[model samples]
Target: MSVVQAMDLGLTFPAGDGDVVALKDVNLTIGKGEFVSFIGPSGCGKTTFLRAIADLEKPTSGTLSVNGQTPEEARRARAYGYVFQAAALYPWRTIEKNVALPLEIMGYGQAQQHERVRATLELVNLTGFEKKYPWQLSGGMQQRASIARALSFDADLLLMDEPFGALDEIVRDHLNSELLKLWDRTGKTICFVTHSIPEAVYLSTRIVVMSPRPGRVTDVIESTLPRERPLDIRETPEFLEIAARVRDGLRAGHSYEEEHV
Candidate 1:
């Protein structure tokens, strides 16, 4: 089953000058268990599209559905989990308590919450740091805890908005590998947004490249690399080839914008 489907979807924000188009003519389908990445220049509506999927923003036109339901319905049903760019953990909450927040809100019994929290923290390799506060953990570990919070409810679709973008290269590389392993183990569908071409090429089963403003998908490149990608794969010829195509797609978008504007 398709995890997400969008058809001619468009969104525009109200502005005093004029209506600003954020996304235009975006049509795509994400199948179950696929890791799809959206890579484009900043202000390209990658996060906007993700927000629309999460029901944080209403579209101005066209249609979008998550797990065969409207975004509103899907959101109310808790159909997916979202991880943001920052590890937005509450500083006062311990790692395990942060992970358990959702379950508590859902009124899960204390026992179930404990079990889920324990399992998710372990999944993110944070088993030994359950009592640590967010400020006490390193940036990478804090982000892992954020991921655990997202996964605490076991939602089948994960919407991640550049969750590792702020980390140092070494830490980001490590988290990228860990994320892939988590995806493999959970078989959850992921929609990721990133600005880095190398990160998109390395992590995605398919990469969707969008244009500048009024974001439209310019290209959707299917990765030829194997699922079990190591950190060194980024240096391989095949990987570089895919990254080049993504770069070309970005350039094409800029060119189109320049000519038309």
Candidate 2:
């Protein structure tokens, strides 16, 4: 089934001069259990498109649907979970308590919240750190806590905006491998936004490469790699081939302009 669908989607923001076209003529569909990555240079609207899916931004035109419903409707139904670039955890709350916040808001019973938090923390391999404070944990561990919080509600769709972008390469690579395993175990659909070609190619079942400014889809590359990928799989010829294509797509987008946040 299609978890997300966008047809001729466009979004623009009003500026003092006129307007900023963040995305234009964007069209794509994401299926259930698919790990799709949106890759482009900064200001290419990768994060903007992801935010549109989460109903954080309104499109000026075109149509977008999530799980057969409008983005707002799907959001009210709790159809998706969003993990921002930062950990965004509350320093005052325990790791588990932070993960339990959504459940509390949704009015899940205390027992139910407890169970969900435990399971999700376990899934992210942060089971033993439930009592730790966010500031007490390492950067990578804090990000895992944030991911556990997102997964706590058992949402079918996960919207991640470069969740590992701030981490060191060694940590990022490890988390990437762990994320694939978590996706396999849960079968949740994930929409990831990233600027790194190797990260996009390494982690996605399909890579959506976008152009600059009024972000447009330049290319969509499907991975030929197997599901059970080891970290070393990145060193294989097949992996390099996919990475090259993504690189070529970014070049084709003429992303030589200065990057914007």
Candidate 3:
């Protein structure tokens, strides 16, 4: 079954003189249990497309569905969890409370909320820090807590918008490995948006390359690497080849934009 399906999708923001096209003619299908990453230059509508799936941004034209339902319908059904670029955790809440906030709002009982929060925190390796506040944790640790919050509800689909974009290299690398384990353990369909080609290639089963401004899918490259990827796999020829293809796709998109402008 397809977790997400987008057909000729387009989104435009109204500007004073003329409208700004954020996404145009995007066609993609993300199947169940797939790890798909969107890679493109800044302002390429990667996050816009993600928001469209989350029903946060309504498409101007074409159709988008989540789990065979309209984005709005799916969102109302709590079909997915979204993690933003920043952790977005509330500073006032302890780690467990932060994870349980959604459950609390959703009317989950205290016992259910506590159990879900505990399981999610363990999944993100935040078990022992349940009493800490957001401000008390390091950047990477705080991000992991954010992820635990998203996973607390056990949503079948996960939408991550550059969740590690701000972390230092070592921390980012560590989280990337942990994220893979989390994906493996949970079997959630993931749609991640990122600017780094290597990071996209490393994390995604398939990489969707997009153009600038009026973002369009220029290419969708499938990875041949095993699902069990080590950071060092990046140094291998297969990894390099996929990264090169992504680079070529990005460069081609830029060249097209330059010529048309």
Whole-model lDDT per candidate:
0.95, 0.94, 0.94
Every model's TM-score? 0.98, 0.97, 0.98
lDDT-best of 1 and 3: 1
Better of 1 and 2 by TM-score: 1
- How far does residue 186 in candidate 3 sit from its true spot (Å)? 0.9
Candidate 1 lDDT over residue span 40-59, tens digit each: 99888999999999999999
TM-score of model 1 (CA atoms): 0.98
Q: Which candidate's lDDT is highest? A: 1
Candidate 3 colliding pairs:
none
Number of backbone-clashing residue pairs for each candidate, in the order shown: 0, 0, 0
- Residue-wise C-alpha lDDT for candidate 3, range 197-244, written one tens digit per residue: 889999999999998867789999999999998889999999999999
